[model samples]
Target: MPNGPTRYDTVLLGSPVWNVLRPPMIMSTFTEALDFRGKTVIPITTRAMSGLGTAERDYTASCPGATLAEGLAVRGEEVSKAEAEVQTWLKRIGLPPR
Candidate 1:
């Protein structure tokens, strides 16, 4: 966090889904302060059931001028089973989907 997102073209932001499928309030504090005008922001989440919840919309609001990529959500009990999804996401983000 000290280095911040200044050097990167993408950011992966995440938190446990809480309170009717929202990230904790503090995430906004972290996000709202930054300028992400040309950055790609990805939301990742570990949720019991909300599955990324309102994160896409939340990030859209908090991080201004950022391209919000499709995010990854792994259920709390299913982390071990989500590797393929994670890899696919990473690949898709890194390389054009074909």
Candidate 2:
């Protein structure tokens, strides 16, 4: 709330291959991007194999009120094979198919 310009109830973060230096900063900026007081912040990080690494830590610290949920680790090389999985995940997260 202190850093954000506006408040957001829920945040869904999906990233694959988080650049080494960019990931932390991205997470920090995201934290600063919105206020999460009394809101549920769902952080989902997509990775090739590392899954969710320090992203969880950074998000946790940035959004103290957030309920840091389990993340989904997607393999970068297998994106094509994971379309169905992606669709399922999108559906689970309330994103209707196009």
Candidate 3:
């Protein structure tokens, strides 16, 4: 794992929903690499048709002791038009667009 801060006040986890699951890499990163205790976790997922699936749930499980915020799911085809939506979500989570 890359060396960096082990603790954070906020964490943004983005993943592509695949087959009703988060990608394996994301799972590994959260479950095996990071420590999220007491942090605010925001799960964001993009899906073609599978929807958000269990991305949020899985992330919550992986980051035990963390505070999970409302998650955001964007349709893959709508990504290009989702800037406003993304900004809104960011704002909702207390991280206004910069």
Candidate 4:
């Protein structure tokens, strides 16, 4: 939420999954600082072993009124090789690779 206008078309929310969930701090801080009424939220989570699990669900719940996109779950070990996958996901979401 950094001191700025409280509006955006899209938001990329990244975090590391802990115990099959997003850290509690993320949930509290983000929800408190930002309002997601009309934003498109794309959640990305990094995990060492567990997969996405409830990360997407948690993000959806956190951003109550936002449009939730298909979330991306990246394995910590594959992060180095995830460029293509990340690009694909970006394309699928109507965003060109940068």
Candidate lDDT values, in order: 0.86, 0.62, 0.74, 0.75
- Candidate 2 local lDDT, residue 36: 62
Better of 2 and 3 by TM-score: 3
In model 1, the Cα lDDT at residue 48 comes to 89
Error of 2 at 42 (Å): 2.4
Q: Name the best candidate (by TM-score).
A: 1
Model 2 is weakest, by summed lDDT over 10 consecutive residues, at: 15-24
* Pairs clashing within candidate 2: none
Best by lDDT: 1
| Candidate 2, residue 67: lDDT | 72
- Give stretches of model 2 more than 4 Å off: 1-8, 17-24, 87-98
Across 8-58, the per-residue lDDT of candidate 3 in tens digits comes to 587777778877566556564655466677778787788877666787677
Report the C-alpha lDDT of model 2 over 55-83, residue by residue, as the tens digit: 67776777767676555556667766877
lDDT of 1 by residue, 1-98 (tens): 55358898988897889965899989888898778778999999999878899999989998888999989888878888987888898897783434
How many clashes show up per model? 0, 0, 0, 0
- What TM-score would each prediction reach against the true structure? 0.85, 0.63, 0.80, 0.82
Error of 2 at 95 (Å): 8.4
Candidate 2 positional error at 38, Å: 2.3
Model 2 — TM-score against the truth? 0.63
What lDDT, from 0 to 1, does candidate 1 have?
0.86
